[model samples]
Target: MAVQIKICGIREDRALEAVIEAKADFGGFIFHQSSPRNLTISEASRLTALAEDRIQRVGLMVNPNDDFLCELAAHASLDAVQLQGSESPERVGQIRELLGVRAWKAIAVASREDILRAEAYADTADFILFDAKTPPGALPGGMGLRFDWNLLKGLDVGLPWGLAGGLNADNVAEAIRLTRTPLVDVCSGTEAAPGIKDVDKIAAFCKAAREA
Candidate 1:
């Protein structure tokens, strides 16, 4: 079966067009200021207002509170929220309740214990994101780093899950083959620079993911 693809950290018109044209399953917009890919509420809506009808629109944030979450929901048109910090399952439930929308929790995975930890959110979070654990003091994610795929082998993840971190056209197929991830998310892997999304790369990544 073809794996679902989520092209993340999209901030430009060309990138948005590439994702929509490529028929990606999801497209993500960053709301955290620490990353270069971060976008304001108006900016995210400007880039994705039309895309909301074409594909799933996700808002990516890091450890935001209820007020911050409410502000984004009121200003931006998003189908889901991806929380990428050390948020508890209770917090994930709060986000879902506050927004009345699907909320995903991103876990930094480096070991089997991390996978077990993710289960805590199974009942609360709408989805689970297993991403690479970034080094200390670095941006939360989108750093082009990958964890050992073997750690996830034969593991029973009890909820809807996706893989993120260091996925590109050249290696996404392998990642899919190894993890059998239903959904694969990419950010820096499809970019030309820190935050610049290359349209060609986006197209190729989608084609690779679909054919995988």
Candidate 2:
């Protein structure tokens, strides 16, 4: 099967249009306050509306509360909600049930044990995203750090999963060839600056993933 792609931390119309035009499978909206790409619910809703029927809209949250999730679900028509915090498997299940949307858990991979830990969410989450763990006091992701892809060689986590962290047009093909990840995700790799999505880079990344 062909590799699927997700362009994350999308905050504007041009970037989202680039994602759709590039035929990426998913477009992510960051809801966390610390990230430069964070978006208000209304902004995300508008972008989600524009992307309806064109691309899968995913909302990213970091240890969000029930009320926040409820508010987002009521307004944005998201295809999935990605939890990038320390949410437990049961909490993941509850959030999935409460939002009535696909649930994704992002695992920060610094070692083989981190990858194995993803199995814990296999039954609860609809998808697992393996991203490089950032340093202390930094954002959870989108910091452009990548772990050794060799760790994923010949691995299986019993559920659909994707690779993220530090992927760009230049290295995406190599990343895919090594990990054979069914899906690939990019964030700062396609940016002109923090939170600034570059259309040309987005196009090139998608082209590279497709050709791989």
lDDT values, one for every candidate: 0.89, 0.95
Q: lDDT per residue, candidate 1, 18-114, as tens digits?
A: 8899989999999899889999878976876768689999989888987877777777788889999998898889888988889999999888898
lDDT of 2 at 161: 93
lDDT tens readout by residue for model 2, 150-179: 999998899899999999999999999999
Q: Name the regions of candidate 2 deviating beyond 4 angstroms.
A: none
Model 2 residue 29 lDDT score: 94
- Model 1 misplaced regions, further than 4 Å: none
lDDT of 1: 0.89
Question: Model 2, clash count?
Answer: 0
How far in Å is the alpha carbon of 29 misplaced in model 2?
A: 0.6
Task: Highest lDDT: give the candidate number.
Answer: 2
